[model samples]
Target: MGHDTVETPNLSFGRGRTPGRSTPYAQYARLDELHSLQHPRSKEPAELSFIVTTQVMELLFDLIRHEWTIARQALREDDLPTALAALRRGTHAQDVLVESWDLLGTMTPQEFNSFRSLFGEASGFQSAAFLHLEFLLGNKNAALLTMYDGMPDTQDGLVEALRSPGLYDEALALLARRGLELSPAHSEQRYRPSEEAAQAWRRVYTEPEFAALQPLGEALLDVAERVTRWRQRHLSAVKRTMGGKPGSGGSSGLTWLRKSAEQDVFPELWTIRNEL
Candidate 1:
């Protein structure tokens, strides 16, 4: 038996440093700047854990957003290879995010309580970038846009994503182009399943053409599964640490996060899987 993986070479900048051996990785590596970060409000040792976990999550979220953007762009240009690379990035980032929750899990109730109030009305729900990423993934909830209202860049970005058809929309459209008879009813709204899309995907899986696109579909599914896992793991962490207490940012904490955990990233992509 044999296996294959797609490799997308990146433009990693390093000056005369060996790939496998470096005395101080950071010294040899490139960093834009870190001067503005790591400002822990409380002088508590545990506060560092809370702040670092949040920052790590934010970084992972940024990577997810980047990959989804690449995936969307790939669909637009009919560049499935590029799209697959982007989706793979999201899949890898999802693993990192789940681990971040594990880091937060180390903070016991007493540890969290010391610095929880310092967070003020700032909960993960209020993360505008995260919200925009959700909308880009085809989850449109108008109410979630409220937090971005006063912030122009975030508001504009999310509003644009909401109006635009998502990555899956482009994929279904591609299937239609590839001769799937997608009924208008199937795609009208609500991210419902498409018989045509499913059939086309089935053909792709059963008799794959455009060899790279096979991995494209798989990569998308991988990303979806990993993201869902991250959510589920985070919810477990929250429940373990805080129980049903309200979130520091004013939401209904664990209960509210539980509902968010159910939100799907690419709904139709998963629906097509059963038919395949």
Candidate 2:
């Protein structure tokens, strides 16, 4: 019992052979390239957090956009379960996106000032990914496309998104297919909250026949509410860091964000809740 036995090392592959360049996980993730992208402009210590957080938020924005696009396509195909799943995934992405501000929120006005000038004309308001997300959520402002005039591909895609059917459009179409009297024109036009649409949602909630749509409506509402909350958090962050200053991208900053936040994401969903 006192005698010690030799211990053998556990190696899945050949001894001393580490997972090399052929590793599928590294190849698929391209983590090396991803990690290489963060080059902050200033020597300020806090700039690193700002840079990485913005990059993370941009990546999350892409994920949210992808999921919402999947949800819109699913809705178009009359697949409620698949659409709900995608919307739920998108909400998770939004949750992370909203929390991302906490990292940058730690930066004070003086800290941000160190590298703020390095930003020049760049600002979160100019984020094309976020603009695309807003378009998909049924808030299309064609004027914003002007901001990307130098980027033809991005501008064209945004124009197409502006004309395309949004998530709310597909939701209304689903309701129409189920015998609700919603106009197809709502799919292309800037959406306005209508009394008739509210009544339809009321039916979806109160009537047993339309019960299947209840969860879809609630999921859509959940997304809209989360988006609004994210906007509120964004406004708060900007106010805390910059206070009344104009955005580096030539926008009105907090005033503009405040007005923008007041604009509802899915208007009919909230309007319907009043009737319910």
Candidate 3:
């Protein structure tokens, strides 16, 4: 008979490489799984680099979304330090995503064209988690939501994330907690620029006492800015590979991505920056 047993990660926490350096079974178990994830369609050697880079970026994006979710909850609860920690984690994740792009940028146009046909209908457009991340950031679109309905479980996760408040929503809530007036409607799933929210953030910027929240605001902006950079670079890559062509996923390629890049996730977060 098999009994229920929970496996714990055997990690050696120590000061230096001398004590905790050699982790055999535990390290091997995780790394082996990571190694098996890449299955590129093409025999071309460079395909491995492209596939691995995209996968790594996706993993980083998942981590960032998770951290932001936690941070948003913490801010909603008026827990500053916990919110700050999560935001810091998110910023670190953003850095990793940007660096992953740099590695992918190494793939020449010829190399991408080699594997492009093999990808068929598989595009970054089909990344369910990425769509959910976008929806979580209050960039919800009915068309995008419908794309996931065929995949019930994926659609469910996205629906939940969409209904939840974003990092900006929580920040506005925090301002309200700090005696600043913000409309209740600002917390809704659809993003709309609130003149009142902007005024509140402007006050927070002017006051030294609200400096911690200011840093939190700037950290959120850093995340938004980096993500925008990623989208732009992705568009650039698409143009470089297949100039003015339709995407493999049935979109207008660079044109679609250009429109997407123009849409800001947390609109008021950026608008407030101008006022501040």
Best-matching candidate per lDDT = 2
Compute the lDDT for candidate 1: 0.71
Task: Supply every candidate's count of residue pairs whose N, Cα or C atoms clash at under 3 angstroms.
Answer: 0, 0, 0
Which 10-residue window in model 1 sums to the lowest lDDT? 183-192
Q: What is the lDDT of residue 275 in candidate 3?
A: 57
Tens-digit per-residue lDDT, 147-172, candidate 1:
77788887878778777777777766
Off by more than 4 A, model 3: 1-29, 186-190, 208-212
Error of 2 at 72 (Å): 0.4
lDDT: the better of candidates 2 and 3? 2
For residues 115-232, write the lDDT of model 3, one tens digit per residue.
8899887888888878777766777665677877789998888777777776677777788878887764433346777788777777778887766677777777777887787788
Best by TM-score: 2
Q: How does each model score on TM-score? A: 0.78, 0.90, 0.83
Shift of residue 60 alpha carbon in model 3, Å: 1.0
Write down the lDDT of every candidate, Cα atoms only.
0.71, 0.86, 0.75
Worst 10 residues of 2 by lDDT: 10-19
User: Which should have the higher TM-score, number 1 or number 3?
Assistant: 3
What are the per-residue Cα lDDT tens digits for candidate 2 across 47-142?
999999999999999999999999999999999999999999999999999999999876799999999999888898899999999889877888
